[model samples]
Target chain A: MSSADLRAISQLDEASRKDIAQWVENEMAQAKLRSTIHNFTEICFRKCVTSIGTQTLAKTEELCLQNCLNRFLDTNSAIVKLIQEQNK
Target chain B: MAFFGKDSEASSTQTQDVKQRVMQEAAQELAVADVTELINNMTKVCYDLCFPNPGPILTSADSKCTEQCSKKFMAAWNIISQTYASRLRQ
Candidate 1:
């Protein structure tokens, strides 16, 4: 990190520092979540689209990608809601 | 007439301006970092996806691999985001 980085970071008070840290942590966690989703799709399509026979993706594999993406999000959201309910 | 709270309001506004500036700067840094990261990751992923194997040294063919990979990765991101957003609303 450079002096500019230290300047920007040092401007924050304790509460502000904590708030910014949490914000960054949350964004990074979400970024990782998204990267994993993308990787999952990339690998799945590669596995299913073997042989290099078709120039375009198969309709079924496309559908599978759609379903896979949603189901993954659905799984996460469902868990989140369940946890929220438990906490209440 | 005398006023005791006027300076407090002035100081509060100055503080508010500082807070706003800090927040804006922070948001901008995060946005820039996110964009650069996305581009870097997309480049790497696209390269691997398009050219799984390479020789000891990359040739002109490998250069095209990187180009095509970026184009397709962007297309995929656009399609996926749009498709998901529409399906999400319904």
Candidate 2:
């Protein structure tokens, strides 16, 4: 939003201002979620689907995509945990 | 405070209308951004998978491979979305 938009929002009543703030927060969270999913899908697709022989994914390919997503998340948390432990 | 102030009431309504319009615009902008990212990512990934080598002209086989690659890419996206959502719920 522009600074002018911010000034307009600030002119709103307290309740209206709170509602708008909440909505903006929700929109931001949703955008982040979408971006994460998009990145994951691209990464897993590249790793699992080596060949595009058919319109439908092969059984192994589907399983690999699922496994790839799960492992990526697992790796994320595992690294976070190790970092937290080191800080302690 | 003037509970019956005509000017106050009119301005309040205007404020509400403005708020609604801004929210709607923000929602639409976010949706468009998400779709733009999806299309760009799809094009890059599918192009790499379907066309490993550049050709002087597009061939039927290349076209067919591109079609199949796009479909499979969507399938992968759906599966990944579901898996990610479920994991978040857990």
Candidate 3:
């Protein structure tokens, strides 16, 4: 590492180092959220929207999009549960 | 000779300054990434939904469809984001 890198790390107190680490962890979680939201939006949009000319979502389409998120989460958990069961 | 160029107190203050700057930079980057992602997704979803066919002229219907498509896409994005966030909390 360069002198600057060494100096930077050395400068941080334990608490400051922990705070920086926590901030980075939080940012990573946020980045994951952004990725998931983008993906889910596309997936649900395709599933829910058929005719796209309406100014407002039809009642059925709105419900489908809402349910899509729940089902997506449910499916994810179910898959994880299945994997855990298989591993055991 | 100490490896650290600065004394303890000075180093702590310097570290705080750096930490603040780093966080601000990260937040700015996150904001930019969010807006870029939104625009890209909006363009893709709206184009597919609104302009299913190619036409030389942009009709009123096409613009209206694109507007609604943008709104619905945003709504879906928010709903999914919230749902994922809630699930993460559990």
Clashing pairs in 1: none
Native-referenced TM-scores of chain A, all candidate models: 0.55, 0.88, 0.72
| lDDT ranking of the models | 2, 3, 1
| Candidate 1 residue A80 C-alpha distance from true site, Å | 8.7
Q: Which stretches of candidate 3 lie over 4 Å from their true place?
A: A1-10, A85-88, B1-10, B85-90
TM-score of model 1, chain A? 0.55
Per-residue lDDT of candidate 2, residues B20-87 (tens digit): 87798888889999999999999999899878887899999998998898899899999999999999
Candidate 2 lDDT by residue in tens digits, A1-88: 5555565676667667778878888999989998999999999999999998899999999999999999999999999999999999
User: Where is the poorest 10-residue window by lDDT in model 3 chain A?
Assistant: A1-10
Go through the candidates in order and give each one's C-alpha lDDT. Answer: 0.56, 0.86, 0.77
Error of 1 at B90 (Å): 4.5
Residue range B1-90, candidate 1, lDDT tens digits: 121112222244544554456556656766676667667666656555656776788787677656655554554554455556665688
| lDDT string, candidate 1, A1-88, tens digits | 3454435445545455466567657866766655554565454444433323333455764566566667767787999999999999
lDDT of 3: 0.77
DockQ of prediction 1: 0.13
lDDT of 2 at B64: 93
Q: Which stretches of candidate 2 lie over 4 Å from their true place?
A: A2-4, B1-10
Please identify which of the two predictions, 1 or 2, would achieve the higher lDDT against the true structure.
Answer: 2
By TM-score, the best candidate is 2
Per candidate, the number of residue pairs that clash is 0, 0, 0
